[model samples]
Target: MSGSREEQLAAWTAKTKRVGFRQRNWSVVRWLAALTVTLLLAGLAVSLLDYPPALAAACWVAAAVTGAIMLIWFFDPRRFRARPSGIS
Candidate 1:
């Protein structure tokens, strides 16, 4: 069911407060997940050598992509924007 405008705004405000408090924390979770997947794929690639080279190549490529994402998430400039103290 659709909620009223006031109710919706209140809910949004509460969620924003929670999200702001938890900011940058979930970045750790993403980095961990990326590293885990990359390591697993790298191991598989080593084990699969001389077999399906294409599959290993694909896994290595996926690892590289995720590695780039992890780096970007850790070093992104947009993540550090300063909030204005006064409302315009």
Candidate 2:
């Protein structure tokens, strides 16, 4: 609060970058475990419902594509900021 606006901005920027870096630095094992669990759960639901093979495969593919899209959207730093109202 006591510093110049530029100093405050710089501090905020550094803190944001540090958080983003930490998010991106997650271990491979952790990533794999999360992915495995998600896929396993999806597969389980598909199996328990007794869906046909083709339908089950389609469902799996759709889930994967959707998940990828969601992950990309979630991790994009720009998504954290509000868009200007007139930009649309």
Candidate 3:
């Protein structure tokens, strides 16, 4: 309420960019952990249940592919493009 709208927008944009940068830097570690968990869960499910081998393999492949795509998106700088700072 204090600053002009443009000033406020710029401030918010800067803060978001900073946070995004930090996340990007740590994304590799996060992605690894996520993949590890996903694989472990899939393995556990397959082992504990009576799922068909083919079905279990398919599900594991699908989950792995989806996670990989998401990981790529998460670390992609282009995907996190900040709004133009010309709001004034």
Candidate 4:
């Protein structure tokens, strides 16, 4: 019956909806934070090797801010609605 076919399509579409969306959101945020933490830790590690404390602090702060940005924007990219490259 047509009703049965509709139900099957709906069932399959629901599974896809439950799948990629949350994982993609999580993956972007998680990896961004990991990268930021790595940068901060690397900066800290190199400061004792004469990288300059001010430079190290700046690196960590920059990383933290970038990570925070990713966290905020991970929900939706369309919300930004602008060309980062400045090309309309």
How far out, in Å, is residue 71 in model 3?
1.1
Model 2 Cα lDDT, one tens digit per residue, 1-88? 8799999999987876656532342344356447655765776677789876666676567667656756775576654544334532
The full ranking of all candidates by lDDT, starting with the best, is: 4, 3, 1, 2
lDDT of candidate 4 over 1-88, digit per residue (tens): 4569889888777776655333245566777888888888878887878977888888888888878888776766553433234322
What lDDT tens digits, residue by residue, belong to model 1 across residues 1-88?
3799999988888877656532354556487676759766675967567667676766667777767777776676556544444522
Greater TM-score among 2 and 4 belongs to 4
| Model 4 deviation from the true structure expressed as Cα RMSD, one decimal place | 10.2
User: How well is each residue in 1-88 modelled by candidate 3, as lDDT tens digits?
Assistant: 7899999999898887766533244555467658756875885698569877776776677667767777777777765545455542
Error of 4 at 51 (Å): 1.8
Candidate 2 collision pairs: none
TM-score of 2: 0.40
lDDT, candidate 2, at 12: 88
Q: Best candidate, lDDT-wise?
A: 4
lDDT of each: 0.66, 0.62, 0.68, 0.71
TM-score of 1: 0.43
Cα displacement (angstroms), candidate 1, residue 18, comes to: 23
For candidate 4, the 10 contiguous residues with the lowest summed lDDT are 79-88
Error of 4 at 19 (Å): 16
Please identify which of the two predictions, 2 or 3, would achieve the higher lDDT against the true structure. 3
